[model samples]
Target: MSKWAYSTDGFDRIVHRIDGVETVTYAIGQGEPLVYFHGGGTFHGFEWVRPLAGEFRVFCPYHPNFGESGDAELGGMGDYVAHYEMLFPALGLDTFHLCGASMGGHMAARYAAANPLDVEKLALVSPAGLKSDRASIPDFSKVAPQDIPAMFVADPAWVAPFWPADPSPEWAALRARESAAAFASREDLSLTDRALREGLKGFDRPTLLLWGENDRIVPLGYVPEWEAVLPHAELEIIPGGSHLLLDEFPAAVEALRSFLKG
Candidate 1:
């Protein structure tokens, strides 16, 4: 029997195919749909966001070529948007709350701007894609293995459960593969992509700009640009929060709950 067949933890995994490419998503909770897009970092699964299951049916799908998803020829982030064009309908995401973190936030922003789907509310956590001169994204490719986790969170201990103290060659290889996938799919990687920012100029929807005040990856310097593009969007910054604020701060979850409720 499928493990999901008898499981009752409000959790289940689904393997769905689109145009012959298979991607997996972990679903939890029981209510309206809330789709979360992950960042460029190594995605193991939901952590702090797991508590959200109590309120909505959260679907966290591994981007194609990342996590449990099968490989696909991705020309750029546009291709990722196209993938969701097919995947959303397949998964019954007609009118759902949308949330994306890090690189996932970039995709979510693009999708929300371009697609006419009913995104009741959009939540972006430390979104990338907006060009910034004052603060630049550090090259994770060049960062030493021992010092990488600190870039994602204010404290490194938060990631201890996910990353082994001593990563194996296999782990390093996986990180490289994921990094390559993100770099190749992103049309511009110098943290200077105006395509998404320009696209957002016309996007006037209820949005939540959630960020950690101390996010090292995408610094708070990008705030003005975000506010300019999404002038009507609400902004919530957590004190001493990191890029992975969703996992590092419980206040982040509470803020999400309060925003998603409205």
Candidate 2:
């Protein structure tokens, strides 16, 4: 088991070894645990659900090879499931709320489907599991850098904040590396194809599905698809959010908070 050095960000960060993968977890608050699983590409999990931290004890674990989480070349999604299965019990959590966004949301749904007794509630935000009308997912690596910001947010203004003010060689190199790693391994990591056909049928839980009205990635049309399977689930759309609803829509945090509270 490898140890990851979490920056001294004053957050309750801990490292756990499970299924030979060392996961970096950032935990906050002190009530019932609410696991906040972020998207596949990002570095920080705290940023994904910072606003919800006050309402629930949040446990955000960085998946292997992303962010500060070490890489162990996981075979598939089941590796993640095995790790979390051991993790929750090890942390003395027999039951908790599981919330995830994008790829994380897909993982959360799978986790709930596999361990319904352990998850009290589930929230999937702009989730990516269901196979779309298209046979294959668009390759992110093939998309030009200029297209990334547009694909991610409704407003182009949001793009400025993500890019560097001074494009130094080191910064550019690092960004390139991160982007390559993210896009390259997606075929091996994505749950889109199999998740919907096989995984959707068994997803019966108190599920909340959140969508961005302007989400270009998943497209709002997929809402009905989710509703068909998760008939008991409640759905909400945050306006002006593209694929990155949590960051693009300031209102998403409040909307989710209210939904969870209800």
Candidate 3:
């Protein structure tokens, strides 16, 4: 299996029931707890984050209607926030570090804002929840499917390991399902909720805002939106990077490690 497939053999599998649906969580290592919210198929999966497992107990969860998690017909992203608010305590997480990327980042931001005191630190990587000026001509959704992968990373070769030489229908379906859920999680991509803004004002925890310099999906323009909401967050733009920051830049993971462990 390609490392990008990220085998779960060495990890501990934990299941927690929420809203009558069982959610799966894969955990590794033991130290300061660090929960990572994955963007799943949207950002693509890889083993790059495993290195952090050595120093932090990393929890990777599959959001409802995505991956191994059982399906749940939720209202919207706000419902997701409610699901996790219960899921966190059910997992016995009292206080912990949180990291989120892409769709997951958007979820993490809302989660931390609501429960800021439970999080000791927060990290957002290329989160989706804002509307920025169209970065690509005609926009990324209009691009051909085969060409879409190239837009995620500066070097297309980095994604070579992710594609199976002979992909099964099941594999393709899982990817499509995850992508759909990424969108369904948010009814609208705009983060202009007055309640959310007020919540963020009270979230005084340490925060990190990171983005790939060449991120075509979210674009650097959205960075300022996050900055306005989280003026205290530390911002870092990685060079030679794309939307798939972890895949294109080793520095992305290192920067995250430094921020979380600090």
Candidate 4:
């Protein structure tokens, strides 16, 4: 059976082909549809979103060039936004809740801005894509492989799931692909999109900007730019949380749940 099957806690993993591109999708849970866009990493499924299955039919799709998903003719973040616009409808999602972190968050914001009618609500967790002259976002491409874990969370132990005990060749290959995709997608302004930043003002959806107070990858200084553009957005910061605030802090989940439910 698929790991994402309709069991009590499993997600149904399937190969969904959209526009000649084969994408891997994982779906589980009950209630309204909620799509999750993962950050820039070897697309390992997030365990933190499992609890949300009780309240939402969660759909997590590995973006092209990530995980088992096949590569596409994507050039930049704009291509990703356009790709999802087609993928969502092809997947029978007319309108749904959308959430994303890091680079995924950048995609979510642009998508919501472009297709406001498609998103019921929006949640951005330590999202990248906005340029801030005041603060510099760390260049992950320059970060050493051994020190990448520290860039994600304040506590190194929190990255236990990411660090494989038995480092297999397959695992290493997957990480390399993810890194390449991330680097390719963000060759401009270190992944910050001026167009997306300017477009945020047009998005009027009920949006939540969740961040880790101590985030090192995307600094807290970028919060103001997001807020200035997204007037309807609510900013919530998790104390001691790093770039991966959602995974490191339970309060982050609670905050998301409360916002989504409200």
- All candidates: TM-score: 0.91, 0.83, 0.90, 0.91
Q: What's the number of clashes in each of the models? A: 0, 0, 0, 4
Clashing pairs in 1: none
- lDDT-superior candidate, 2 or 3: 3
Clashing pairs in 2: none
lDDT of 3: 0.78
lDDT of 4 at 108: 88
Per-candidate local distance difference test: 0.81, 0.69, 0.78, 0.81
Q: Which residue pairs clash within candidate 3?
A: none
Q: Look at candidate 4 and tell me the lDDT of residue 72.
A: 81
Instruction: Write the residue-wise lDDT of candidate 3 on 13-50 in tens digits.
Output: 89999989899988888889888887747325536667
Q: What is the lDDT of residue 207 in candidate 4?
A: 93
Give, for candidate 4, the lowest lDDT window spanning 10 residues. 1-10
Query: Could you give the C-alpha RMSD of every candidate to the true structure, in order shown?
Result: 3.5, 4.3, 2.5, 3.0
